[model samples]
Target: MMSTRLEPIQIGAPTGRLSDWVIAPMHFNGFAGLPTTRNESVKSPKFSCFGHQWRLLIYPGGDRESSDGCVALGLQNTTKESIEVETKFIIKHPHGGGDIRKGWDKVARLSPKGSAVVGDVGSARGYNNFALRSTLLDYLFDGALIVEVHMRTNKPGQQSAPFVPENPAFQNMLKDFGNEETADVKFEVGGTVESAKGRRKRAKTPTNTFYAHHYALRWNAPTLADMCKPGEVSPTTITNVRPEIFKHLLYYCYGGKIVEGDLQSDAKDIIEAADRFGIVSLKLEAEACYVDTVEVTLDNIVEIVTYADSKNLALLKEHCMDFLSSANKIEAAEKVSFDDIPSHLMKDLMVAFARREGEGSGNGDTLSSMRVSQLRKLAHEKGLSVDGSREMLIDAIKDDEEGGETES
Candidate 1:
């Protein structure tokens, strides 16, 4: 099969929430793996913005008052004196279109105490219910919550729009991209991947071929460019992805957007192909679509979670955990055949199960936060003696699981 390179797109700088006034990013990496009890929170490092010391505190599960659905946020006046400021949070939605909620423009009189936002901890002036977990899951990318805080600042974000000089001649440079008139690059798709380095081993007697310009191809997909070195005249052979899928990827890289219908057809495949080509945006779209559109249930939870963990798709894994938490944990554990799941990911499932049922944090020696009832129930079910303190109960369970003595 042969196809020409797609036309260029008009991609520009981001046009969502402005980041000039305050660019404090709250990066909660591996949020799904670090299971926390509802109301339990983590703090981003203190950042300086608007000539003030500020820190972002996020409750991964939910707010202190209502931990069921809301993921709350808090901003502290780290300086000595109190300050009254209007605030808004722009959740950099993982799936792409940022979730910027209106009417959250809160003007609070924040004080300096034990990282105090209002009168005291859990008092007024803090972000009470910043976002909901159900909605946030769709926003998250790779199980990370990336948020940008914008404050009412004395200075305007920008004095004037930056200038973009245009010359009709610039487009002409790429005009020959799809034209065989001078296209300098060739791609052969569908073959075997080299196991050692994870790159495709050039197929013997390649069949499928595509044409593209060297500069355009190199800029869009570097792996392909690297293979077609500076002076090489041979076609860069690729394997593992279908030629049709490559067309979508190549088109998107050249400034085109993939249609929703194509993503709906084979989002998982697209996600894998996009990731392989270092296409972050497409990967995020497929991931977000799969979690948002696909129905998650006990029957497919194991398969999905396993695939997610393998790909390091934290956002999808988090969504899977949310579904399992809502479903019966006992039944979910039974339906989750440990044999299919890799040894490493089994711990995540157990931790999520324990977190939902017992409100436990991620698995470790720090199982003290887990409710005694949940631990005792698990221990009793394992036919182990449940006569001990919280630490002792944890040790017993850990021993059983580690020793491979516990049943699925």
Candidate 2:
């Protein structure tokens, strides 16, 4: 049994969006007196997304730059004004298991079996906060970071709140970016807003107004807890293993950040950890490795076949069968092919057939010739008897059938 060596995979530029599922509420603690205020958001001045409620908020640079259960849509403006988004929404992340050949988008939607783990949750009130913070942050910060915005609703009369980029800091932040020219980036993508008097509300409104309660865009990178880690080792030791991979892992821990280059050997161990921890990108890298260089072993072959059988991975099972040709194990091959017997297994099955044939010949006196003929006929129909021997077996079976009829 040859040990399958997993090859190192080369990292490539991401083609699809990242997964950032909302798991918490995005709130501002120091908002004087609001129905939703958080102590954590005030002391350190950082907002969160989707934990108990779904939210989208601004990123205030700080040490504790990590949060659980919130999908991070990092600073991205691939197109003008529109921030690039990444998420692990229950309906989004590609659940390829360990298969690498599967495309990300193709695997994005969850099947019925996988739906429970990916259902939508969290609140829309927090969504309003996320939008406001993101728009305000976009106004204050350089183009360096984009705010996060949410798209799902967890309550009635609540939906994605658009960011208002026309506030005070909005101009100051634009000036810092050398845009000097003042412009308003409208926030309404879809849906309508009504005023307190039941009339239509415009984009600009008083802070005390319900429309002002809308959220801004905000995103964070992956954290230490999000990335792969060595077994029971301190984070410092992990950094020493490979500074770059460790840094990438740190970003993943904060949120998700994929650094390009050859992943270190220690990184491989961490990738394994990432798979266990539900880090999507790390699992993707591991799958790439399995596709690129992992050798198929007997145990792996069995696992692949079994899973393929269960999941209808016909191509994968076929590849496994081809790989097992040289092993020359009859029972194993039979299990994989369901007794169909690959050409490689043909010789083994043939030898067994010859032995059985010889035993039957020696026991000719134990059973009547008619019984043997009938057995040969059944074997011929199953392709178990020799080619062109069908006529002889049929003739014998016909004679036996006739003799039995006469006797009756």
Q: What TM-score fits each model?
A: 0.41, 0.19
Q: Per-residue lDDT of 19-52 in model 1, one digit per residue for the tens?
A: 3444566777876655457777788887776566
Error of 1 at 155 (Å): 18
- lDDT, candidate 1, equals 0.66
Q: Among all windows of ten consecutive residues in candidate 1, which has the lowest summed lDDT?
A: 10-19
lDDT score for candidate 2 against the true structure: 0.33
> How far is 227's C-alpha from truth in model 2 (Å)?
12
lDDT of 2 by residue, 165-251 (tens): 655654443233311122111111212334333476443422220010001111121232333222322221121122333334333
TM-score of 2: 0.19
Tell me the whole-model lDDT of each prediction, alpha carbons only: 0.66, 0.33
Output the number of the lDDT-best candidate. 1
Model 1: CA > 4 A from native: 1-177, 191-207, 217-219, 346-408
Count clashes in each candidate, considering only residues at least 3 apart in sequence or on different chains.
Answer: 6, 46
